[model samples]
Target chain A: MNIILVGLNHKTAPVEIREKFSFPEASIGTFLTQLVTSPLISEGLILSTCNRVEIYAITENAPECFDYLSRFIYENQKYHDNISFDQLTRHLYFYSSTDAVSHIFRVSSSLDSMVVGETQISGQIKEAFDYAMINKATGVILNKLFKKAISVAKRIRSQTKISENSVSVSYAAVGLAKKIFGDLTGKTVLLVGAGEMAELAARNLVNNGVKNVLVTNRNYQRAVELAREFNGISVKFDEIGVELAEADIVICSTGAPYYVINSDMVENAVGRRKNRPIFLVDISVPRNIDPKINTLGNVFLYDIDDLQAVVEANLKERQKEAEKAELIIAEEVETMDRWLKSLNVVPTIIAIREKVEAIRKSEVDKTISKWQRELSEEEVGAIENLSQNIINKILHFPLSALKAEAHLSGGSEVIETTRKLFDLAEEKQPSQDPEAPPAGTAESPEEPISRSRDSRENQ
Target chain B: MEILLYKLPLLFYFAGTVVYLLFFSIKKDSLSNIALGVTGIGFLFHTFILILRTVESGHLPLSNLSGALSFFSWGMILTYLVLEYWYRIHILGSFILPLAFLSLLSAAAFPNEIRSLQPDLNSSWFGIHTTLTVLGAVAFTIAFVAGMMYLIQEKLLKSKRFNRLYYKLPSLDLLDHLNQWSISVGFPLLTLGILAGALWAGDVWGAYWVWDPQRIFTSVTWLFYLGMIHGRLTVGWRGRKAAYLAIIGFMGVVFTFFIVNLLVEGPHRFI
Candidate 1:
């Protein structure tokens, strides 16, 4: 079987078109069920997020599978009259076999994310795979593929510094606060204005477990509105001093022409706070908080430019780490590619073993029935074991050669010639048993092939 | 065998220093962990060397220059290990382990031959005095390290460079807090140590107060640290200014421990 992926991501399609093709989480199971109903797709999974819509499948024929899946997508969506199927096809990207595996690996490892090192895609892919497995839409190929993808993502996450720092302004603010306070739990955040940036910082602080959020604006109504949205309390503008004294962190993003928080106010607040450190984030254009306050003991002031600098620096660091992550992905893809190619030889090996074993059993039965004297059960069992062992020993070298050749560039032709020479395709129906031993099963006659596969996986 | 044990720790410390320096330059976090492991093993060997010397010489092994240097390095490592454990800041090891290795390396440069204890150094009060003094000096060394980190972090934040080292170093608040705590804990122990040393001096030379250069320098170091603690407590002098004073006080400690003993030829020259 071949692995295939067809999708349109943020790079290929705008949000308008991507959203139109996204599969809802609740309907994914039904959608997958409908997808695998086609004989072309043996196993299937659908990954639909705000940024992309992708379908991954295992199929016997790549072109047939791609055609069916694309048609399925086209027919399922209510297209605009001005839009044509050709235009839609232009937006879709297709990868087959090894490229398909690499695409999925990169996507799952967050390398293909809109934000290069973002972590959300890995979880989304895992959820999609789980949904497919629950709906019985996946089998051995997809199971192994997804397992390897998730593990590759985990390895990249741990072995590299890809996700070490925040690359956004609000998150960088919270990160700096955490650096100062160690933990944000039970800490108080004071929002000096009801501007969007201040609210965003407050929201991020709340998400990081800051206990109390106090908002203050020149207009009380706006402060109350912002406070209610964050489940916080609103204070009058005159009470900024008291709030600043009580707050461990202060986010200022007002549109005032002058510094709203002067040195005297902050100095008084610092004295009242018993010299506990205060983190002041002034994310305003003209700078809302006085720069002189940074000179005060136990006070740290960062303006809008400073936070943006942190974000930029963190993004650069992440870019460097992304380089390492790409290297890891490349190595992992090579290993997975080897394993996938080796899978092509598995059916041939199983078919040849069955053919030989069948011949041995039939010959042994004929020999036993024609015996002159009645043989005991032990003697009959010994003969059966002897014939089985002889068949296994004779088949070992050819199976090893086929397994070793599977990883080479032209190895599939060799496998095809062997199958034709032995007439192995005639016995393919028996070899298609769902209850047949899996590729890595211990009891199979192709044990060495499976063992080498296992070793590759461990690496 | 004892000599080999002492030399073995020097090699371990050197290895740890190299690993920690690599961690600093390359930003590989696992190298810091390896550095910690190597340092921990080296600390074990250091402790064994001290114990063996103490038992073999029937003294606390704080008489000569090598012994004093080894004791001082041991105290620094012990304090650093506790702080590293409590703070869980592996990067600090990149700063501290090298200092520790250098101390031990310098000690190894001196003769480590065990000698019989001088009769004047046989009193238990002498051991207590020297141990407390070394512990106090170690605390100041910790403060020095934390202060240096604070200054570096402060400069990074002030200039808004935010380079690779800026990411690897600890926060300014944490470094300042450590500096303050080391001074607070080290001051009282140093006071007691000075008193004990004064008493030992009176017993040895019939003078409770000596105007020797080492004594004066140590007293000056103590007073500087006291000023730092007082400033932090009363006037809220912290951050950059406080960090500068801590660094200066550590310089005083080095002058008192090394210069006054080796160059000035004071009454405390046994160290």
Candidate 2:
């Protein structure tokens, strides 16, 4: 059983369809336990976000097991229509084995997410895996695969400049404020209007260590609720000019059709503030902070469109920056592929060599035992030395041939043919010594046998 | 004798110029180093010929028109090589190669022979004056190159088209500082050179100043560069303004170099 990610995401399904299949936080433990208990399923994780719900699982008949997975989810969630087989049919993505492993990795790393390079997916993917691990629902393949994917995501982020330099102008405004003052600590922030977007930005500001948060909205209760949640003060929407004089950073996101803060008012406020740098974040529809306010001294006023475009432009450039990261990934992928291909040669070579060495070892031990009664210790040791030299001299050529073909095309077939011809599989250990020399060390270079011995042993 | 003494070196300078341009196009560091070494050796031989002319004539070689031009251009090459080594700026070669070859061509092609050596022009103070003035012109020529490169680099950086050759340029901050320093240093040297020339003129011709075409153009150069240094120091005039001033200063130099001397009948018309 290997990686098989099944289910729907934003690309294929609507919210209604996804909701039916989504994993609620409360049910994930039970969900993953049931998934693992299925004889076909070895390990599984449920990545549930609002946009999509995908199941990363280890199962052999990845395509065949869809009915069981969908039925279980439909019965448990009790959401409308409950994502049936026909609905799940088109939206589901099944990655068998390696493709499945790489898919989960890309998803967890956020490489496959709707928003490329978003930091949220990695955390959510981790939560799902942690839930699975808690229930004893993981195996070697899933564990290594998920862990490697997580690290790959981390590598893509830190090594590439894609995540650097904030894209959002809301972030940029906050960024400039930090650049000027070194830290946002002890700085009072006044967010104008309790619009949903403004509230979100305000929360982000508080998260980033703003000392004070003040909210102002036309609706008093909205401001009060936002302020109370963020441990902040609420102000009347009309008193924004007074609030502006106090705020070191102002975020204005109002849905008003007309301008809120006029240039003349800002100009007067600048005079009262004694020319201190007043950061104005205007996330308004038509515009809240007056465009003329920019002409006022020391007032940096950026509107909603400006911040979004800045973030959008930043994301576009990040896509460009991702070009370099793509190069690094391609290099790593090629390297991993080569190493994976090389692993195929390892088992065959080891098995064939073990056979020849066993035969030589057996001949040495048998000859030693045959003379054990008549010979002195020196006589016995000398015959043992002769047998080893003869075996090594006999096996050298075929050993080199097997190793030479190890990396070539049709190399494995030649190795297999050599194995079958020599009947090396039959030369499995006889009366095994508890400890034997490691493979490379075990081969005797001084003996210089033809690789024919290995070929013959394989046959 | 003229071809051996002048044309031979110009050929070497021209060939060295081509090699250096090739060296940069390919980005072969060793080839560039070799180009510098070849040009340096050519300058050495050029220097030897100047010394030989001095020893034969019992006067500093710049007593005549062609001699002065050769000494002035030589100063440009020698200073460039010295600063290149000091700064390790291989890209500057891409700028200086054209100037070096052209100046050498001017020196080689000038018809200034030992035209009945004006005994009055051969004074010790005149030698000192001419040397300082010529050296000052050479220093400004180097500054002019730096200014042009600064403008190009600033444009490329601002456009955000930072390509391979863009990285090869000195940083904008570095080019700005160097551009200012070169103008600052060159301005004062031009001033002293003009002052020395006046002193020597008075000693020889019983007049401290004569508004000859050459002298007029030289004064114009001094004024333009002085304006630049003042603009940069006081007005914080930078970037395009500084670049324009430097170009103006070099134009005066060119007028003094080829045009004024050839077109107008002046004391320096021996060319």
Candidate 3:
């Protein structure tokens, strides 16, 4: 069975939808059992960290299994039946077959995680996979995929400084603010929409020693919930302008159709706030705050795109590690491919034996008729023995070639072509379709996964 | 046994310094460990050499120009190891290693007199006086190195040069703490050392105080460090200004050790 991972992540799913679909720590075992029990699924593992929920399955139809997982998680599944493809499809990413394998390698390696080059997610992915293994829910395919991902993660860590710095947008916004104000202890934070992205920004601001956080949301209860968690006060949604006036840092992540913080409201806030330099971050999709807010004096407004430059520089630093990580992945994949290809041994030996026996029988019959009148019975017996020796000698070269090819993978081009020319193609006697379950992961050849586990576990 | 106890250390010192200098040019942090290791091995040999010399001479290795100077230099090298181990201040090594080499060179230049204790030096206070002053001088040299690094670091920080020194020097706050911390300890120890010297003078020379050039210069170094320490804590002096003052204080101590001993014709004369 081939390894496959298919699902949406922070990059593919909207904040609201992703939040609704996220799995808690308590439900992983049940989810794993459900995923593995599917008709097409051979073995499966689920990696459901905050940023992603990827279902890695060894299966014939990954799309069906992946879709089933999504449907199970999406609480309001009925609404999706009427929704346009663009509405749902834009936010759902899919990778098929080997591409699915590569994507999972990248994800479990944290190369695709929202915070590029983060090391935390790899360990968490391994923990998820190991838990599945202990339950016997994960078999060979998942074992290789998960273990390969861990090796890639390690190669990246040793080779690069990807995790050396905080290059996330939330952090960049705070860093830019620090450069502007030189200090953030007395700053005011005004958050829009109690969205998860908004909460992360709030937490970053609070970490920089923010004194007060003024929160607003269309849902007052959500605002109250966010404010209580962050030790802040909730204001009426209509009072955003007045609240904006009192704040030094404003982050608008409502993902509203129209601008929530309009130019006029910002202009008034600028005047009311007395021209103090304010930092605003718009993390909303579809653009919550107007782009024109950046034109205001003493106001530094950054959209999500603005954060890409910071992440780009950090990505360069992490690229060094990514190369090493990818090399490790390519090596592991080739080894696994070799094992999968080697399972053709049974068919190869059967075909070789049948061809040699037919050649011996034909030569024996032809010689027996010619010598019937002139030779003694003992002479005919000697001819039969000589014919058997010739056949036995002929089979040696092909049998050795087949044996060598079986230990490795696909037969030699010269040997296989010769076998076919000599009428030796019917292998394994066509016995019941030679149905072999996908090649099993007999403990990884070079031992990267076991090495890492031993290092951590023994310690 | 004699080679291990004596000449081998001098060879290790020369070899260790070369390795560190090469590492400084090549920008290798690992080589810093090699330098430290080689020098650490030299330090072990030097300790045995000093003890053997002291035992053979029936002295504490504090007598004569060569022995006193060698002991003082060894003290500098020992301080370097402590700082490197405790603070992991790799930047300090570039400055510290040279001072040690220079002190050892000066010690080599001096004649080893092996003079038996005279009545003036035989008093109960002589060992206390010389030991305390040498201890104070060691602290002074360490402070001076920190101050010098601080000056270079301040320029780099101000110019926004994020080089090796910028990254490796302890934080500005930490450097400031160390410079003042060394001075705070050094000045009072120097003061006590000088006070004991004067007390010994009263017992042997019939005066508790004298205006001898060596004594005056040594006392002057103590006061300079004292002033710097006081200025830093109370007046909030820092960065380059504090660094320069530390440099000045160390110059006085070095002057007392080298110039005053060579040129002056008082009780603390080298020639």
DockQ, prediction 3: 0.03
Candidate 3 per-residue lDDT, tens place, B155-193, comes to 543343434444445555456567778887787778888
**Which tens-of-lDDT digit does each residue in A1-459 have in candidate 2?**
224566567766666667777788997888788877887566777778876677766554443445566565556555555556555555555444334544565665555666666778877777777887888787765676666667777888887655654665546555445533445677788988877777777766777778898988899999999899889999998898787788878887777888888887777776666555576777777776767766544556666655665566557656665666565555554443333335545666677667777887888788778878898999877877887787678777877777676555455456556767877552322322223211112112232212111222221
**CAPRI grade, predicted model 1:** acceptable
Point out where model 1 deviates above 4 Å. A151-155, A228-233, A239-243, A267-275, A291-299, A327-346, A358-389, A396-423, A426-459, B1-8, B37-41, B202-211
**lDDT head-to-head 2 vs 3, winner:** 3
User: Model 1, A276-374: lDDT tens per residue?
Assistant: 789899998888899988887768899988998999888888888888888887788778777777877888888888888888889999989988268
Per-candidate DockQ values are: 0.46, 0.04, 0.03
lDDT of every model, 2 decimals: 0.81, 0.67, 0.68
Candidate 3: regions farther than 4 A off: A1-31, A38-42, A48-120, A123-136, A139-165, A168-459, B1-7, B14-28, B112-120
Better of 1 and 2 by DockQ: 1
Residue-by-residue lDDT tens digits, candidate 2, B1-271: 7557666667677877888788657644467777787788778888888787788777777755678777876787888888887888887877777687787677767665655467786556766777777777777777777778767764543333434455456744455556677777777777777787787777778899887778877877777777777766665556545666677788888888678777898677665
* Residue A443, candidate 2: alpha-carbon lDDT: 18
Model 1, B1-271: lDDT tens digits are 7567778888988898899889888866678889899999999998988898888887778877888889988888888789889887777787888888888888888777776656764666788898889888888888888899888877766666778888887777788889899888889889999999988888877889978788888888888888888888887777777888889999999888887888887667764
TM-score of chain B of each: 0.95, 0.91, 0.93
